[model samples]
Target chain A: SQTIHQWPATLVQPVGSPLSLECTVEGTSNPNLYWYRQAAGRGLQLLFYSVGIGQISSEVPQNLSASRPQDRQFILSSKKLLLSDSGFYLCAWSRGSSYNEQFFGPGTRLTVL
Target chain B: AQSVTQPDIHITVSEGASLELRCNYSYGATPYLFWYVQSPGQGLQLLLKYFSGDTLVQGIKGFEAEFKRSQSSFNLRKPSVHWSDAAEYFCAVALPMEYGNKLVFGAGTILRVKS
Candidate 1:
């Protein structure tokens, strides 16, 4: 069975600090990866997605960026974090087809103070 | 623009009672619909998806949703509610893009099961 893993289950960062969140999938290769953020009272918003290595698509312009350094490894980073960047970040993986359902990781809770 | 609407922000039901959560979408055509659930501080789990064929789709955790084209709605229902069912439910629509499909999620409805 395939599983998705995310690091730093919880994080507390000061404003203007650098941030990095990592996600990796095991038992699958060349899977589609996605990054999403969920605010306190809002639904999830897609931040970025990658179909392959070195290929990342930004769904919305914001302070975050994503990179696919390996086939199954994806990283979400920011040079300087903002207060608005505090939220629950999720990492998901799906099969190659667009019709496939996405599998999510445990997620990372980032509190920017 | 394509969007998903979950009318109920929060719902409370007694244990073993019937439950229904509403969802509506606005799109040019029939798009892929989905239902997901999220426990507090956890990621969303795929409950069900509607691609084509039957209007009613069965999902995990004894959940089912019916897709009504005329009304542009896909409402989730459960015959009996359980205390463990308390969670946030989200309705999503897949918007096909040039590169890939993007899922637009609703504001979500939080279900509170009272025993």
Candidate 2:
């Protein structure tokens, strides 16, 4: 079975500090990866998605960026974090099809203070 | 543009009671629909999805949803509610693209099951 992993499970970062969140999938190759943020009491917002290595698509313009360094490894990064950047970050993988279901990771809770 | 709407922000039901959550979408044509559940501080779980045929779709955790194209709605229902079912439910629509589809999620409805 395929599984997604994300870390650190929880993070506390100072304003203007750098941010880095990593996501990886096992038991699958060339899977579609996505990055999403969920604010408190709100639904998810898609930040970025990648269909293959070195290919990333931004869904919305914001303070975050994504990179697919490897086939199954995706990273979300920011040169400088903002207070609004604080939220629960989720990483998901799909079978590269429109009808396939997405599998989500445990998620990372980043608190920017 | 395609979008999803979940009317209820929160709902409370007694254990073993019937439950229904409303979802409506705005799209030009019939799009792929899905239902997901999220526990507090956890990621979303795929409950069910409707692509074509079978207006009613069964999902995990004893949950199901019916797609009504005439009303542009896909509402989730469960015959009996359980305490463990207390969580946030989200409705999503797939926006087709050349390579894949982008999912637009609703604001979500939080279900509170009281025993």
Candidate 3:
């Protein structure tokens, strides 16, 4: 069975602080990874996706950036966090095939104050 | 360009009543549709997906969705509602290009089931 893991299930960061969120997948190889942010009572907004290591495609250019340092390991970072950067950040993994059913991680709830 | 639309922002139903959520999509090619559920403070879970060969697809947690090519819709249904079924539902359509893995999602439908 494949499983995705995210770190810092809950995070509270002050404004203008650096941020880092990590996501990793187990039991799968060369899986596509994605980062999504869901606003309160709103839909998910795709931030970034990676097909392979060092191949990150950002959907929305904002204060956040994503990097695939290695296969199955993705990182979301921010140089300086803003109030708008606080949201429920979810990491997902899908097979490289056409089926592409995304499996989500536990998620990280970020609160900026 | 491919896009998904979930017309219902909020839906309320009784515990034992049949529930249906409407979803419409727009795409040039045959769309790959998917239904997902998200509980409060949890990640989205795939309830069902429609690729081909089946108009009606059954998913986990006793949820089913029907794909109508004519209407460009894939509506989700549950015969009987449960309090546990009260959650946010999302409709997604996969892009039919070289980057087929990327999906475009709708605004989502929030379900509130009364006891």
Per-model C-alpha RMSD: 1.4, 1.3, 1.0
Mind sharing the TM-score for model 3? 0.98
Query: Candidate 1's error at B11, in angstroms?
Result: 1.1
Tens digit of per-residue lDDT, candidate 1, span A1-113: 99999999999999999999999999998898899999888888889998889989998999999999899999999999999999999999888776567889999999999
What count of clashes does model 2 give?
Answer: 0
Pairwise DockQ winner, candidates 2 and 3 = 2
Clashes of 3: 0
* Clashes per candidate (backbone, < 3 Å): 0, 0, 0
DockQ of each: 0.58, 0.63, 0.62
lDDT score of residue A46 within candidate 1: 89
- Ranked by lDDT, the better of candidates 2 and 3 is 2
DockQ of 1: 0.58
Badly placed stretches (over 4 Å) of model 1 are B97-99
Docking class of 2: medium
Clashing pairs in 2: none
lDDT of 1 at A21: 100
Tens digits of per-residue lDDT for model 1, B1-99: 989999999999999999999999998877799999999999989999999999999999999999999999999999999999999999988765444
- By TM-score, the best candidate is 3
Evaluate model 2: give its TM-score. Answer: 0.96
i-RMS, every candidate?
A: 1.7, 1.5, 1.8
| 1 or 3, greater by lDDT | 1
